[model samples]
Target: MEKLLVIGLDSVPPDLLFGKLLDSLPNTKRLYRDGTHGTLETCHPPITVPAWMVMMTGKNPGALGIYGFRHRRGSSYTDGYIVDSRHVSEPTVWEILGERGLKSCVIGLPPSYPPKAINGCLVTCMITPGPEKEFTFPQSLKNEVRRVVGEYAFDVTFRVEERDSLKRELFEMTKKRFKLASHLAREKDWNLFILHEIGFDRLHHAFWKFFDPDHPKYVVGNKYERIAEEYYGLFDELLGDLLEAAGADVPVLLLSDHGSKAMKGAFCINQWLEREGFLKLARPPLGVTEFEKAEVDWTRTMAWGWGGYYARIFLNIKGRERGGIVPPEDVPALKSELKRRILQLRDVSGRPMKNSVFEPDELYGVARGDKPDLMVYFDDLNWRSAGTVGHESLYLSENDTGPDDSVHSMNGIFLYHDPNNHQNQIKSMNAEEVAPTILNLFGLPIPDGMKGRAVKLS
Candidate 1:
């Protein structure tokens, strides 16, 4: 009852549990045979930061005050603030446990930028920098996060190689991360031990063609499927290693924040903005021509942008506080107008959703006060929106007919094991049931904030 181990694998969709190539995944299937299981419902919009935070604080994003990435946009530059404990209004699971004289170990969970004060070990993830020296966790555990990410943890840039060595490096890192977590579990005698794997999320982003049969990126002429094969195969081995490492005396759980797909087609938010009078343009954008910059009006335009699983269109009311069109009195009308306009477009495939955007309320059933103003789900569920005002990839060039060709689904995979039997049984589950069950398992108080029910462990 004093020891619980949680392994977080990002972007693992629940449907991958069948007899297909992924279903044949030996260790995952073995895990099902050995454990009592169900889906862990991720946070609304199912993005990584929000979902994990929900698990940590046991509060909704609205209540927690981390509404999808950061503070609201300012017109020109829209870099989001990294989520931190200052923004968390309620006590987290770690804090609650610590109050009860129990210690916990937390590592590499996103938006841990400011680094919360936790018992035992505190290795922060998604932490930003002016100095790495500022947030190093006891030097020893900091070394572990580095062991998985190397120098790239601080500055993640693109690599030119295909799924060759880079993919192998990721798998090796996944192996080490879990191994390190297992080592920590043996080392710490506490109520909760958590390790979130960044591999699955990266795999979904970089190797979608292999798992997604519908991707335009996939080709019969290439080795894409091999990417999925090798990635999952290695993960299966790692899960087995984790199971063996834990030695079957404690509850071991596997879960993901969200699932993914490579989406094509970008709905130019600026395009929509200009059309709706929410945005103004400098000159000619992607498809426009014969425009003179001097003749175009800039004072009247707003900004529009997108990203995987999300989008935003807002007025340029940042500094013009005295006389801005989106004034305090107009905020209500503007939000409604933005929501109405986004729902009008469709993806290239003609699905009503590809071009639609849902506000936070629509996505999570949470109140408007706690959610982002707009949540857009692409057509085919594979189409994505751009987060930047003007992106080059939104429009198809003469040679490119496909949309962005990159996407991800917040829907993901979950696995749970019994402490008594090593490998006994398994099943499917919806994502919403995850939080309540874990709190129930830890014997922690479940807040009224959660909409999910605890899965029965007995």
Candidate 2:
């Protein structure tokens, strides 16, 4: 049986990996040239939390019962909770393999904070509050991780004003993560190993405008114009070293949860709702205020939205929300009206923005948990949805919460390198296919409930 190594690079777009940065990434480039690589279609609301979980569990967001990182708690207006490992009830690939007596080493898979016990070692993901808490499975592994990398970094604060300092922390965090990964690969006894790095996503979110000339905010000949290349080169070098540590013949799978691209701007969804009479406020905000902080008259409001890479709109329907107003039978008509108006919205320059709206049932047949009544992608994801209110205009040139240079896209990336069989081919695959593909590589049967089929690599 062949050992499997899965490297998850969060928010890596195919164009950059296979185009601009290809030559600079010798390790990734070689894999792409010799392996089967292509675009991996991400799940709806393509945020990291659910996408990575979706890939690992072979379950849709609905099945997983997680919509985004933060979910509204039982339709409470202000109450919400961040998703963590406790929320994931589905059996992951590692858990499934463990049942069959195969050991695995897993690291940094999101919503994995308060790390759960596995067949092998496990280091929780970005959601971890800090290293002081028990972030490793079996508890003893925490000491080993500290001995290897001093203090483990769960994530970085990317939405800061200081670019130089942010850049330094980003690279340092990645180096430490890879160093830990390399050390564990050599020391741990495991048939399967998985490592996820969030640095690439942070790089894109913070420095995209500096590197990509086509970005709306980009200026030619900027100081950080070459930052993307430098980061990609460093990533490739670390990847090469980690592969060496893993073994020469291990089958490697490289993928990302979702892709990243230049963010045009943020559309204040709640402000728009207020303007359209869907959301009502007792009084106008004095200045910019988060939706939760604003004085909302929920009794009069029809719908409200939460912001992220995409917009999640919830209707204040009768007998549903605490302050329900819209009648249950009137939901379809209201949703239709809202969708029509949203699609007709224009950009700042008065051009028709290409927006898409989806109901939970439309995207996932069996919608579950605290799902939004409407899922919206402003300008097909070019424009991020801003949940904050009190902005003068419906459009803003930056993210409402903080500084963000990029937004999530539907297509990420996938690369499979098999040393034994080099049947190089490029083909698109869905996020659900990854779990089954891993099972197939180890000659294990994919569970009947999995939504995807195994990809034939040989």
Candidate 3:
């Protein structure tokens, strides 16, 4: 069987590889020329948590019961907790391979907290709580990582407002993650090796304005203007190193969970809900950050939203939630009405804003308990949706979390290279196809539950 080394970057755009940045990324250019590569269409509500899980498990977010980094635990929007790998209901490709005596190494995949038992070593992702906790699968592998790379860094702190500090931490985190992954690739005896890096995503989120002068918030000739491109160069160099460490005969798969683009502003979704009479509050809050402590008139509330890289809307349905209002029989008409109204919303400047609103049934084939009632992409993903209430207006100049410059796009990257068997240039592939393709490459039967099909690589 061929040894497979999978390198997962959090957010990378195809345009970066084929456009002006091409000149600086010679290795990536070579991969494009010599192997099969194309845009990878991400899952619905394409954020880091669900996309990675869908790719690794060959299951859609509906099947996995995970739509984002956090999900409603018991039908109430406020009654939710952060998601971890334990929430995944299906078996990962690593576990399937491990069951058959294959050894693998998994590092830094997001939402991989509370690390589970695998065939080999496993280091959890950014949500590991902190470096003080034991994050490795074997319980002793943390010591090995510390000995080899000083400390394991799951991810860097990303803040668009703090340009210098964000850049500094991004570089340091990238270096440490690569060092540990390279060490494992060279030292460990494994058939399947996987590693993930969030530096690219962080860089894009914090500094996209620097690269795209067309961005609404772009500052011309700023010191940080070239920073994003420079980081792409670093990513290419690191890719070359990891490829070398994987040796000449091994095939390498490179991809990201989703792409990213410049964000113009944030849309206050909860405020919109309030204006539209979908949500009700008992009193005016002292501040927007007081949402957790605010008293909501749930009986009068029909819907509410939560913000992140995207927005999720939940309906207070009768017999389902604590203060249920919408009846089960009225769900279809209500969802259709809300979707129509949301799409008709305009920007602050009174210009029509473009968006795509999806019901869980349309996107995922069924109504699920944990999934949101509606998933939205605003202004073609150039604007974020803020879930905070108490905003003076429906739109804000900055993200609620802070000042973020970028939001996730639907198209990511997928490149496959096999020294012995290579395919022609492919146009596109879905995140779901990855796991079954890997299983096919390893001569394992494609599991019945997987919806993805194996790609032809001859």
TM-score of each: 0.81, 0.99, 0.95
lDDT assessment of candidate 3? 0.84
Residue 182 miss distance in model 3 (angstroms): 1.0
**TM-score-based ranking:** 2, 3, 1
- Pairs of colliding residues, candidate 2: none
Top candidate (TM-score): 2
lDDT for position 17 in model 2: 93
RMSD of 1: 4.7
Residue 45 miss distance in model 1 (angstroms): 1.7
- Candidate 2 structure quality by residue, lDDT tens digits, 187-253: 9999999999999999999999999999998999889999999998999999999999999998899
Model with the higher TM-score, candidate 2 or 3:
2
lDDT of each: 0.59, 0.92, 0.84
* Candidate 1 residue lDDT tens string, 132-197: 554445556666556644542421211224556656667666766666666766665666777777
Q: In model 2, which runs have C-alpha deviations exceeding 4 angstroms? A: none
* Comparison by TM-score, 1 against 2, better one: 2
